[model samples]
Target: MKRITTDELRAMAGREGLIIQGCGGDLTELVNGINDMLTQEGILQNGDAFKDVSVFEYDGCTNLLFSMENVDLNIGKLAMWRLQSHETFGGTWLSDYLPNRLGVDMDQPPAQKEKPDCALIGQDGNIFNLIGIASRTLKENGLGEQAKEMRERIIASGSYDKALCIIGEYVNITSAEDAQEQDCGFEMGQSY
Candidate 1:
């Protein structure tokens, strides 16, 4: 329930991370579409249309000031992807893609499953939910090798919950190459 200033956010990010502005999905595209529609209807000037009115993040979580006015504008999700990675292509989360590829419905209430975004993986501790979903998706989609490896790592940790949190917080395996390059290891107590 704590909020940090933009200065704190900047300090946390430094120069090594990216702050993606939108969900990069239909929700964000809908905002752009609405802006275009408003412009065409003469409600908004051509140059005054919303470019990227996205949700903002404070310390990698969605800053919840939700409203009809701000919903479509402000940074939706925030994460630190690896340097030199393409923002849109590389920053996509596994939960975001699992719905479409696996025909899993994500429209259910948050109580059913955590929303793909980390901000919603909230105080109740739903990181394990995310890891379970991702683990299933990986196995279902023929990434059994990776799934097996992930399972082994989680089991070896001797604390399933902590292992899940570690993966949820530190792992960034957005792609196969990312998994190869960013192997699941962390120096204990390291911020990144």
Candidate 2:
């Protein structure tokens, strides 16, 4: 994936006819909190740089738009989200684009199967097994190709709603017991 800056992102939005100013899930809130924290810590003196910025986040992708004066503030916010525990499933968009804007070089992609950054974790701590919902989320986010891949995986997994699909992979349908017998260290958890 290519990395881009807020300025570059703005240009891309213009070229793609996308809305540059929008709301990303929790991105606005998190930016606000970080700005407030920075102000209190005496790291920022000219009010908050991100106060007037616009955000666009969805389906693990996040984008921001702010003035040059607050570039550092925006960079700080990106750092927090990109390098912190906020990226539970590695589904955040910070490292991919924002850091590149700040001249930061990120590591290369992993050699293993690249897991999808998004997942549906139920309130009961069970990862959702509903391929339909997953497919819909990807499709609605303009990731129609990813949605098709998800369906293919579901079909490959026998489309068993009760089957365990780890990291969104379509592989052997070995149960926890079977894994244990084979010493694969796999365990099944409750799903809601």
> Which candidate's lDDT is highest?
2
Clashes of each: 7, 1
Candidate 1 off by > 4 Å: 1-128, 160-162, 165-192
Tell me the tens digit of each residue's lDDT in model 1 across 3-38. Answer: 334433222211122223333345555455645654
List model 2 lDDT by residue over 1-192, tens digit each: 122344444232211111222334566565566567556655455574444344555334565543332234444544454355343424234334433434433443312323333434431323334555555545434344556666666557654553346324523222335535345444446333
Worst 10 residues of 2 by lDDT: 12-21
RMSD of 1: 18.6
| TM-scores, all models, native as reference | 0.22, 0.26
RMSD of each: 18.6, 15.5
lDDT of each: 0.40, 0.42
Give the Cα error of residue 159 in candidate 1, in Å: 3.3
